[model samples]
Target chain A: MSAGVRLEGLRKSYGAVEVIRGVDLDIEPQEFVVFVGPSGCGKSTLLRMIAGLEEITGGDLYIGERRMNDTDASRRGIAMVFQSYALYPHMTVRENMGFALKYAGVKKPEIKAQVDEAARILGLDQLMDRRPKDLSGGQRQRVAIGRAIVRHPEVFLFDEPLSNLDAELRVQMRIEIARLHSELKSTIVYVTHDQVEAMTLADKIVVLRDGRIEQVGTPLDLYDDPDNLFVAGFIGSPKMNFLPAELSGGALTLVEHGGQTVPLPPLGRAPQEGERVTLGIRPEHFRKEGSAALEVDVEIVENLGGETYVYARQAGSDVLTIATGGARGLRQGDRMTARFDPSDALLFNREGLRIR
Target chain B: MSDVAAHRLDPEAAEPSARAALRGPDGPGRDMIGPAVKYIVLSLAAFVSVFPFFWMLVGTTNSSYDIVRGKAWFGDQLLVNLGNLIEQVDLPRVLFNSFYIAIISTVATLLVSSLAGYAFEIFRHKWRERIFAALLLMLSIPFAALMVPLFVMMASAGLINTYSAIILPTIANIFIIFYFRQATKAFPHELRDAAKIDGLKEWQIFLRVYMPVMRSTYAAATIIVFTLTWNNYLWPLIVLQTNDMKTMVLTISSLNSAYTPDFGVIMVATVITTLPTLIIFFLLQRLFVQGMLGSVK
Candidate 1:
């Protein structure tokens, strides 16, 4: 029912300034792919290029088996839900859902049947006569997705569709979208600046930075094993903590950790003795019972109902956060040593490339 | 123990010198104009704006003698004035001529101008911007300056004494084009992109999506264009050589220029000529408000 999307050497430039540098990717059919990046990282631009809303400056874009760089958007058989919903203001919800099909020369009853099916799926049957301006934000977004559904498009493109909704509504709609993807069994390319959204909804996540692919992997794979500093820093919620360290005699010594040290395990290509490196530890990786240890001068503590985050630091050093399960009797100005498994430490060279 | 010092602080702080004097030397808290004064000023403005229409209405109900005497109230001579107005001008035939010319020209003008506006804005090129700037500059040029050459062009085309002479010259109105260009800026580009994805052609997108989305803009444009074309005087007077070809404006003006002009009859003609514009305004006013609201959204 859906086609795979592929981009080879995809590039976009506005005269001298290239917004999208060379990007290469292949999205499997029926896969939920999320494009996540910081602002100006060209994630939305990339999505728009696939939707054919933006012109391909230099690359081959293929939908199904067709080279779609020159194909009209409507002919490419893809549908997009814009950030603004982009619904016709004067048209009813039913009309908005049915409009594209009507113009595609479908029979009246077939259009009605498709629209009715989409409405039932979206829980918009009762609101069919309502205008976009009259609907709530979440309802309007549902109608927008309904509009896309009626097109029977091969792939779906969503550009920050939930960014405009409230926090609760965003979570609700995120699940709704994930369910839709599964139900339709169509390839979906979703773009967002939010890592959380990418993590929950994506079957595979594509991390973009400065118009280049930084990393492409499953959400947990990226969190557990990032290729570089950017992916490691971006994927985790309480961002993985980095402490300056030096390797000497197969041992890693924390340069700013009050003389704390741990043995370095052998890697694919180990660093030289006395070479500088950064050791990354996720906040949740810290434990009360482990081998490697560093004493921390606690500064702030945030306790959620389920877990508590201890934001602490060594003397004259940046804050390193530690997450411990449940309520721990921790206080600011309380000095304590937090421990972590030696094998859990991630080492990066001065250039931010992984040492292993 | 510190009564005088506290008293000194009270007076100093009681003064609102820290705030600007633009709020009438007092704070806005104390200086807001009361609603009574607001209503008074608004009523005066309303009276000023409506006075001329009221005077015309009164004149329709008065005789020439009473109108010259500055009778401001309704008189019992309305039937007589109407009879005289129809007597001088073949009222129905002249109105039909004006209506046909104005409506057709307005529809044409809106189409051409809005298309030009949409293209100039959406499909921008280096040369199109230059042309748009030139069009804006042309708006500053008095139509009177172009009148003679325009008439000659119409005459050479053998369109003299025809409605085409009047309609053709004014159909590509620079002002309306500028207006549509400005309004078209507020149109969301995403709508067009969505329409394109729906398989609409460029022209079909313009016709189906843009036309419906910018409905308020068109309504406002329609009322404005209709009024301007209906009240068009100088060009039609020069080109439309026959009395049968004359518009309401030319007809009414000729009635006014009679050696012994009947003031009451001219007023009746003026009142009747104004009715269509007023009716159009009333009918489209709701649309105008709705459009304004939509534009803001």
Candidate 2:
């Protein structure tokens, strides 16, 4: 009963300012796709358009090969879990779960059975008689999920459902959602600004920026092979670092830090000699022992028990982070040599697009 | 060690100086008096406000001469006043008319106003917002100025003495619409989105989801509308031409205009007119306050 979704140049605008400028994407059946971006980047708006909650200013939307641009939201065969866990405050959990089913023309007995099954699945059976105001935050969220589940929708839409929960509850609910997706095997589109939730939950992550899709790929693919500096910086925690460099004879020469030089793999569209480019490196990509090394002074050491992040500086730029194993004997004002393999570094042009 | 020993021996000195500072010159007894005085003042104000209602009830049982003479206690004239009220007016028919108009108006007003309010809040557009703002401005126009035009409109529609004339003109009241709009600010937009995705049409969502969730708001609006419609004087008087179509408020007013009117009977009619609204308010007081709190929040 699952349906794949496709958007061909979907656009939304409020009068003159276009919030969602032409976005095109293909979501496979049963594929958990996440739209991740900073706030005001039109992530939620894109989700709303797909859910038929917001009007599409231009372009076509297709669900399972049927053009659904003009279809009412109710006929779209979808369900959404809101960030606020928008359960009816006056209705009990069972009533809230069964409310939508009544309108769907389901029999009374069938509605009760579906609601009871959903309550069991979400472990909300005991709380069925309780109103939303009486339930805790986590329980209310579970009830919200149960309300969506009883619909047995072809597709599920989540608009930052875990954002309102506490940090610990967010982690717990994130896993529960992942389990729910697998058990139901329903096509789902989730929106969130938290990269960790996207990385952990999405089968394919669609990175958006300024109302446009930057890249769409698997979580590991995005983490390892980003197509642009923005994706590289946005996908990883602590963000990827970029150093200014000039290309010379298929080799990159750093201009800022003591003119260090690193060689790049041969490419068909490699920059000409003396052309400026950026070198991208993840914090964890740095090695304790490597062929290439840069001397720097440790400015701050954040020992997070399992791993340590050393914030250091080289030359005049305060733009270096070194992830090391365990808590090393690192202190402020200590001068050390940070090393990394040349092949692990990413090269990007001035336009922020990666160069292979 | 010796200094510590000396300090420990003096328990008062060992106690933190901050504790002594907190005690100050006045003890806890002095703080208690302030709240006591405030409560007494509030109780007196409440008593003064309620005294008139009590006086009116007392006046209903006293003779007209005794009432005008400023008698404040109940006298043995309740049956006499009841007889006079029955003799002068068709009390049962007037009461039924008042109730019919008030109940019908309240129900229709609640449904129309709440629906409009929900629409204004949930379905936001540039033109809708402009229209809503214009409606808010329209609310500032006094009903007095529009009464003549409204009456003319009703006369043209041939509904001069019908309940439809009273109810139809007041159904789309801008004040109740604005009240619903303001109360709807507390309604979470997320619920609407969830309902939309749940395969429910807009109207179904409104009736099944929105109305049930906003029960407190409905209760509060019911009280306000019932009171307004029941106590309606000028409009009903102008429109209702027959004594059979007269509301309790109109009947009471006309009863008081006799050359030698019976004040006791008038008092009884006034109490009868006021009782329904009072009962409605008392029944829904909790919901009224809760609904107001929800709106303000």
Best by lDDT: 1
Which candidate achieves the best DockQ against the true structure? 1
Candidate 1: regions farther than 4 A off: A255-262, B1-40, B292-296
Tens digits of lDDT, candidate 2, A38-130: 888999999999889889999999988889899988888788899999887778899889988887789999999999999999999899898
Task: Residues B1-297, candidate 1: write the lDDT tens digits.
Answer: 487566445644434653344344555655456876899999999999999999999999999999999999999999999998888889888999999998999999999999988898999576997888887888788878998888788889999999888788778988888888888888988888888888889999899889988888888888989999999888888888888887888988898888988999999999889999999999999887765555426
| Residue pairs of candidate 2 with colliding backbone atoms | none
lDDT of 1 by residue, A115-199 (tens): 9999999999999999999999999999999999999999999999999999999999999999999899999999988888999
Each model's chain A TM-score: 0.98, 0.97
